[model samples]
Target: MAKRILVVEDNDLNRKLFCDVLKSQGYVVEPVGDGRVALESARSFVPDLIIMDIQLPNISGLDLIEAAKLDPALRPIPVLAVTAYAGKGDEERIRQAGAEGYLAKPVSIGPFMAAVKGLLAQVGAVAG
Candidate 1:
């Protein structure tokens, strides 16, 4: 089966871009635009990885990452955080919140896919 990836991004264009790229690479992509429903979607989808956007409208992606890390069901899933407004310490903060990977936008396809594959590979190794 193809690896499942949940993409949580507010921007329509960015979300579509990520979804398209991942789907093209044969991943089963679930795109979520609302931060409020992200976790619920994740739980239902049971994705292998999550690609989160930091600057969400209502809730911060960092908080979502923290919540996922705390949840027993979601804890095992690897998260790759993507943000447009990256600050000096933002990456560190995202890492602290339990995201395994971080990328600043506008993200290139190569690096984006690399991070996704790397995180999935780690999961495979752990489960292998």
Candidate 2:
């Protein structure tokens, strides 16, 4: 089965771009534009990986990551965090929130897919 990826990005263009790229790579993609419903969506979709955006309209992606880590059902799923604001210590903060991968905004396709594949591979290795 193709790996499932849940893309949580508020920006329509970014979300579409990420979903399109992942779909082209043969992964199942589910895009969520609202941060408030992200956790619920994750629980239902149960994606193999989550590509998250840190800055959201209502909630912070870091908070979502932390919440997911705390939930047993979502804990094993690796998260790849993407942010437009790459401030100092932000990467560390995101990592601390339990994201296994991190990327900054204005993300190029190369690095974006690289991180997605890397995280998925790691999950596969552990699961296998």
Candidate 3:
């Protein structure tokens, strides 16, 4: 089966762009615009990976990541933090929040896909 990816982004253009890029790479991509819906979708979608935007409406992506990590069922899903906040401490904060990897916006498709693939591979290896 194609790897399932959940894209949690508030911006319409960015969400569509990420979904399109992942879909082009043969991933089954599901896009959610708000952090609240994202948390619920994560449960139902049971995605193999998550590409989350840090700044979001209702709930922050970092908070969502922390919540996911706290949940046993969602904890194993790899989360890749994709955000425009590239300050010196931002990456560390993302890691602290339980993200498996970090990507700065505007993200290049090559690097984005590479990060996703690497995280998925790591998860697969761990699972096996």
Candidate 4:
């Protein structure tokens, strides 16, 4: 089966773009708009990897990552944070929150896919 990827992004265009790219690369993409819904979907989808946006409405991505790390069901899933709020020391914060990797927006297709594949290889053991 294709590797499952949960895309948690708030922007419609970014969400669609990520999903399209991952789908075209043969991943099973589950897209969600907010952190709360992401949590719910993560349980049902049981995705191997997650691409999360930091700035979210209901719950922040950091909070979501922390929560996921505490939950045994979602703990093994690797989270890659894709955010536009990148600043000095931001990557450290993201990593501290439990995300394995960080990608800044506007994301480039090649590098983004590379990062995803690299992280997947480490955690999900599947290539992009």
Give candidate 2's error at residue 118 in angstroms: 0.4
Q: Candidate 4 residues 12-62, lDDT tens each? A: 999999999999999999999877888889999999899999999878999
For residues 10-51, could you state the per-residue lDDT of candidate 1 as single tens digits?
Answer: 999999999999999999999999999999999999999999
The lowest-lDDT stretch of 10 consecutive residues in candidate 2 is: 84-93
Off by over 4 Å in 1: none
- Reference-based lDDT, residue 75, model 3: 95
Clashing pairs in 4: none
lDDT of the structure predicted as candidate 2: 0.96
lDDT at residue 115 of model 3 (Cα atoms): 99
lDDT of 3 at 34: 77
Where does candidate 1 clash, by residue pair?
none
CA lDDT, candidate 3, residue 53: 96
Q: Estimate each model's TM-score.
A: 0.98, 0.98, 0.97, 0.94
- The reply for model 2, stretches above 4 Å from the true place, is none
- When 1 and 2 are scored with lDDT, the better candidate is 1
| Top of the candidates by lDDT | 1
In model 3, what lDDT does residue 63 have?
94
